[model samples]
Target: MKVLLHVSHLVQWDIALSNSKNLKAIEAKSKIEIVVNAHAIQLYRELSENLLQQLNELENLNIKVKLCRNALRNNNIEESTLPATVEIVPAGIFEIIKKQEEGYYYVSP
Candidate 1:
């Protein structure tokens, strides 16, 4: 199973991360990708220790992290400051649509 998690607001990070963790725990074979856009892009920079640990856990689980290039520019977040595992996409909405077309279950948390 492929899951695409869409996180647009800063406040949704916790729930999104929690859901990703739960999904992996429930099915280790599940493919998970977390996409960040809008205000959520800010969280990708200068992450708190707690959030950094959570992201490391996601990496350990083999989950992919993607950030929107548009969002990064709009939020003034540098790509270099993000986690090495994160992929920067051209656009978040387009990426989400493409993932769905490829049969990835979309979850907005």
Candidate 2:
């Protein structure tokens, strides 16, 4: 099964990650997508190395991490500043909608 985790709020970062981890742990073949947008993009950038390591661990576990281009523009953040693991999409909401149409279950914290 696949899930699209829509994360728009900075406060939900930890909850989203933890739930993704739990899902990945319980379902070995589960597909996880983490979409970070809005204030969460800045939150992602401001994260410490340790938290980033946790994110890396999720990537290692095959979770796809996405960032929104519009969110970056809104926050005045450069696209080049994002991590190597994150793929920049045109917009977070659009991506989420596409994923939903593609049969990916949506989860939000």
| Best candidate (score: lDDT) | 1
User: In model 2, which runs have C-alpha deviations exceeding 4 angstroms?
Assistant: none
TM-score of 2: 0.92
lDDT of 2 by residue, 6-101 (tens): 888888888888888898789989988989998888875565787679778888989988999988898888777667877889989999999999
TM-score of each: 0.92, 0.92
- Model 2, residue 73: distance off in Å is 0.8
Q: Model 1: residues >4 Å from true position, as ranges?
A: none
Lowest-scoring 10 consecutive residues by lDDT in candidate 2?
43-52
Candidate 1, after superposition: displacement of residue 29 in Å?
0.5
Clashes per prediction? 0, 0
Instruction: Give lDDT per model, in order.
Output: 0.89, 0.86
